[model samples]
Target: MSAPYAIPRSHADWRAMAESQSFETRAFIDDAFVDAASGETFETINPATGKVLARVASCDAADAEVAVHHARAAFDRGDWSRIAPGRRKKLLLRLADLMETHKHELALLDTLDMGKPVSSSLGDMAGAIACLRYNAESIDKVYGEVAPTGEDSLGLVLREPLGVVASIVPWNFPLMMTAWKIAPALAAGNSVILKPSEKSPLSALRLAQLAKEAGLPQGVFQVLPGFGHTVGKALALSMDVNCLAFTGSTAVGKQLMQYAGQSNLKRVYLECGGKSPNIVFADCKDLDAVAENAAAAIFHNQGEVCIAGSRLLVENAIREDFIERVLKAAEGMQPGDPLNPDSFMGAIVDQTQYQRILGYIRQGVEEGAHLRSGGESVETCPGGLFISPTIFDNVTPEMVIGREEVFGPVLSVFGFDTEEEAIRMANDSLYGLAAGLWSQDIDRIMRVTRRLESGQVYVNNWAGGDMTVPFGGVKQSGNGRDKSMHSLQEYSELKTVWMSLTS
Candidate 1:
């Protein structure tokens, strides 16, 4: 279904929305919006204007204890877990409908809170809504299985919900990531406590209320908006939390796993950092298409994407021509005011990420990598955290910029002579999240894709997949899948029951 709200085209209109927009600044627990137990709050800033958006509740250990208590109680009481799959499906469907109705409001929250373009924020809303709907529809369709057994015996394999799930999501794609974690978890009848990134929690807070309105049971879903050191750690260390689903940096994912091992040995599913490689061969059918896709692979969402194709490996025969085309494409994506629907690129998520990206650019220059284009901040929007799409050429695989995940609109280009060399360079990193390959020869495509050490590979295109496919990574990128039917398994447990019918 199409988005129901009319997008505001002008900057003035969006500015007005920002001025009049009401925010949910409290924690959502036990079906109510309340302040943190310690009554502490933290400010969420709009990177575009460097202005305070709202003071969200800064939940700590005490607040996490309370939320987890309620969540466990709700799950044990079977308020939701014991409900019929059809009933859960209906409620989730209602929540999706509510989200669709408030699509513009939710989109505005992300735009104002984290500085993505309003248009892209709207697109995020659509994707989030679709994810919710897909999981909701799958609720009743998922069925148990009967195993082959002796004539007098019966064996049944059933999928059951884990008790309590703590979902820690990142700020880059706040609502979308939140939906990705919670939709299937909730659909499977698990009680969920969401810890959204302190930088972007408004959309998640609002989503909790919508879920409540959609008839989710008390404590079935909760939102705790706070820092990772306090609320997030508490949830991770809680013995009562049955599973933890997280999406963020690789370092944080490792920490969460440690916490899980130290506490309940709860299931930990993570989708973390990526420095995906986009390789273009000499036999590419269209240089222009590949260049355009290459620009978007790194520049989309200001390149805050975890699976962004930040490393470009082009065959030497076509490196010069392809690089020129890519530079022209990057030139068209200059940073602009996020509220303007015409704008493609927006401000960085916050000042911290902005500084982090700049540091990487400086490191690239200091390391002798050639800065081909855009390694400076844009001054068009004064006080805005905007960075130009930066490109660095002659980047050796060992350089810091080439190895680490900058997580910004920075592209590093490398030239390779042979297919083996391209594959080797692409797989040199610790991350194996996603990769892109541009080649016209079918045999070469099959041969190269099999050798790439990545979870997902896009051939002849970039980032070309949908909800039907699984999204996750290997190695340091983390061990979890987010979309499609496979993700449901992460939040569920399998059980076998045997019965003997000897009369």
Candidate 2:
């Protein structure tokens, strides 16, 4: 079937439609959009067009206190946190349905706010809706444990909601990341306060309106839009916030952890940055497929994904041929207007990200890595933040481009001689969020899968999965899982119940 909404074709059309759409810019509290306590505001711009979308309230520590107080009151008063699990599931399902109904609007907002391709944003919206619905359906199915005891005693375990949750999402996948955290938390019967990245906050505010329409109670879900250092730190340090979930850089994640310990000792769940490795063995059935997946992995969302396969590790025998094919595939991906459906790549989130990516490219040059494909920004599209797909070959494990998370359309290729060496190279990084392996040999694939230290591994493909599988990472990539039943446990607390009777 065709998509419900047609993609905007021209820059003029996009600007006309986007400028006419009214958006709310205040902090969401008690089921309403309101300004921050300090009345401070910041401008939200459309990265694709560089136009001001709205003036969002700049929430500070005081605004966070208000939001958290309302959330705590809602939780303690049994409005949401103390509700029946089944009812909470129903509400979550309704919320998902509402999101699905407005998928096109959310997709447009996402593209305008974050400068991702509209078609990709549409798909992400659908995935986010499905994720929420799936989590809601699973809420009532998760069961607690019953411990076996002596004949005279009985022990029962119950799962209860963790009171108030604070979620901080990144700019790359704004609405989807929000749903990733919001769905499970709400389904588990917890009231939440969300803080979206300052770079992109439009979709998050729109989500607040959708949540309200889904019949979520006042104070059950709140959104505070502002700089991370101000409002985000407040959420991290708030004693009333029982749990915190964040997706961003490792440096900020460490700061959040420290803040959690300093104030509340809250449970912090982080899905930090990653420099994922996509390994291609010489025995792969199709080099063309490997190259295609390689391009999509790095080029998708302009390479802002935390799990993007930025590090391409190929077998020494196929290094030359594979690089040629990958370069050919990358030529087809051109960064342009995000609103155009034909455009596979789009702008960076903002000017800061654009400059950051440029700086990294310059670093790759300075560090002596061979720039094989693209390494410069496009000057024709001056208004939009555009960077060509960059590939660095002959990259050692020690180079900055090979080690750090560039978070742009940058790929570093490293050649390995043997299976053991390939596995060693893949597991050498501190971040092990996700990895991919391309090979036709069953034995070698099995051996590599068992030895790889990543949390999620894709075999012969780029990205695939839904709410059925657990999504998380090992080591410095962060703790706790999202999606599936495993994610539900993060928002729930266990309680032991014992009963004895003598009649």
Candidate 3:
């Protein structure tokens, strides 16, 4: 669309790169790519240019059954599931190594499948590698517990792998989210069935090939790409799956929980939606830095991040000045060709999401929120679904745009009178995934950090830090954590073993 910076690479370069290799389409099951049981395939479109990338296998309930059965059989045989923790770690590390070696290609595929800049996709690839390596390295260090007991008796607490795990990840950050679930699950020595969103299934399919190249056993890891109403529901309803780990909408998470209950009552771990708050005080110093970060938090990845700081809670004393700073910061982030490394943002993922984001903007205007900056279409990118970064000021907590998850580059500004009021407004939302606090006062930082209802809190910056820390949400944002040692427990089942020592 509109790129503020001069193109670092030509459009012809992208065409050449895209023509160099073919993206995978078939489902990977039982250690190989295969047709779906129904023999149907769906076309996965390139969001950046609106071209069909590949015909991904359209797996449904029947294919899900086939995958689950194979997984169950694999788990039952104990070929991989009963392997030593060190051995599994070794295999996973090898997979991580392979991922890093092919990083550029993986990054390109991700950018092509979903409308995100190549630079951003590379970061996602790096994050995925980090997640896998971290999980792989931690398994051998973690140990089962020896409980205290009388001298005559002994108590042992053993951590055992769940037999079969179904991992459902969202379209945004596909590879990274997949690794978040698969790495820990594999480290725990369980069979995994990965269900990537149909909209962006290319990278997951390619990763399955790499997993095989790394020598993961047959039926140990499988990828089924399909619509949620069909294969996703099938996985949820299956009685054989021991656990279901998901990252997506709060509504879908709730529905999956219900399905889990209706079936085997499998353990459900969810990392869902958020309208995370970024609170800035009339700080002692640096409004410029805070303003810059505030804009980036919502504009990055076209605001697809579940923990994006969509709601900006600014102190009343500095609200007007901060909004101007934020507007200036947003000017450089225009929608452009995702293939270019210099591009800050790209097109929307698809028409459905494109329309949804515009609808939310319309809702904001109707509710009387003042349009602050770019909210119009990017006419330069005709075929692509490109939108300029949109910001709304004078937003109340009760407005539709203020309450809902727009999942686009849309920011809502809310002014607060005091520290207590800022905290109150930040905690008012049902979602509690993440939040940020900015202040020079150490006392205010400590107090607000302690009082915040979020699962993860960032001080002085928005979404700071890395994969080593735990991530997830509380309340309506969903249950359980991801991306740390805590995630390992999600795929494991603890058994307390008691034995008598007789003389």
Candidate 4:
């Protein structure tokens, strides 16, 4: 058998890589790196070691306005907004090329800033590159429409770029998520203002430079690094912005929609939080495989995933057996230094998130959920924001751990008696983002796939999808699809032209 995964790098190698990077901390505005208008900056602490990495520009309302004005001017100028679709495609592909060329640097930055395993960030770079290339290639292929018209008149339906789009993305998967939001917007010819979460801003800063290198025009793309309340709120409330697309918490997503209504009522699209459910039936072909997936679904990325399968619902016949296997698999998911390429898990994003996860663990205990394994913070990495991979058994839908999103390495497990009961329990949540089911019975597969109240569903697996599929959620999880041809429509508006041919 192959040896277990380990961080390939030595301590000296990691120390060198960490010390080699320049502490670049500036806002990308008007295609230039500049400080906040008020000259204020905030410390960007490394969650892995509780050390300050850099002092990033702390952009507030005024700085956000600066970015807005710049983007508006760029949009109104029509340089990128009215450029040939083929040309826009070329620029985006060039940016993707640059990103791929610097993949290692980008991956290291993400590992240092957000505390994700370096191995995973490398994978994220691949995804981000794919998203850019996919949107780039498709830009020129998508065509406008001609509506049904009488012989004497013409009705031409056109798709035009929405002017000055503001994209507010979260900390986890920062670079990839930013690419998902902006690639289509940029390809469709919109000037984009990106507000990356303050918790992890390094990759975004690097991305801005790459965009410039790839020939994106001044003000066509910008990055503002600041608190969500400041730059994030400003972006949503800006009258000059024609659209606001956000990916973060469901609570924050709702606030953005309100801000949109309060301001220009710009079109809003959101991909928000989820407490996804993963169900396994007794008839599975292999319980071992199910147990492996169940562990990975919740433990990957240290459970920072928005669609992490935090809820595990197993049929009563195999519930006890499955929990034992899941615990065994979760043993390999210990938190380690992010720079170690082999580490399966990394530090929590921050102290606030760390404490929040611990609070949920305590709540789970109070609610009488059995602590199968892992409950407290590990002392291995004393300064790191590290929480052990935790599992709570016998969880009910009403418990806080079962209902709310902890967004950490925590799993809540429940047992169901029937397939119908499992479906009911899975659908009985405030979220409808994604769900997974495992069963060899073809009829059961068909029935469960149709009944799960989520945007995406998985059978015999969890959280695997291509760039071409639509991904988003229903209900409080937020709205609008994020990938495939549907996302292209999100950045463009429909305009109909009429001509009187008989006159």
Best by lDDT: 1
Off by over 4 Å in 3: 1-14
TM agreement with the true structure for every prediction:
0.98, 0.96, 0.97, 0.97
Candidate 4 local lDDT, 369-457, one digit each (tens): 99999999986565898889999999998999999999999999999999889999999999999999899999999999998999999
- Candidate 3 clashing pairs? none
The prediction achieving the highest TM-score against the true structure is 1
C-alpha local distance difference test of each model: 0.93, 0.89, 0.90, 0.91
The residue ranges of model 1 lying beyond 4 angstroms of the native Cα positions read: 1-7
Q: How far off is residue 296 in model 1, in Å?
A: 0.5
- Ranked by lDDT from best down, the candidates are 1, 4, 3, 2
**Weakest ten-residue segment in model 3 by summed lDDT:** 1-10
Worst 10 residues of 4 by lDDT: 1-10
For the record, the alpha-carbon RMSD of candidate 2 to the native fold, in angstroms, is 2.1
Candidate number that wins on lDDT, 2 or 3: 3
Candidate scoring better on TM-score of 1 and 3: 1
- Cα RMSD to native, each candidate? 1.5, 2.1, 3.7, 3.4
lDDT tens digits, residue span 394-493, model 3: 9999999998999999999999999999999999999999999999999999999999999999998887777678899998998988988889878888
Cα error, residue 167 of model 4, in Å, equals: 0.4
Count of residue pairs whose backbone atoms collide, per candidate: 0, 0, 0, 1
For candidate 2, write residues 316-344 as lDDT tens digits: 99999999999999999978788776788
Please give the range of 10 consecutive residues that has the lowest summed lDDT in model 1. 1-10
**lDDT of candidate 1 over 261-298, digit per residue (tens):** 99989999999999999999998877988899999999
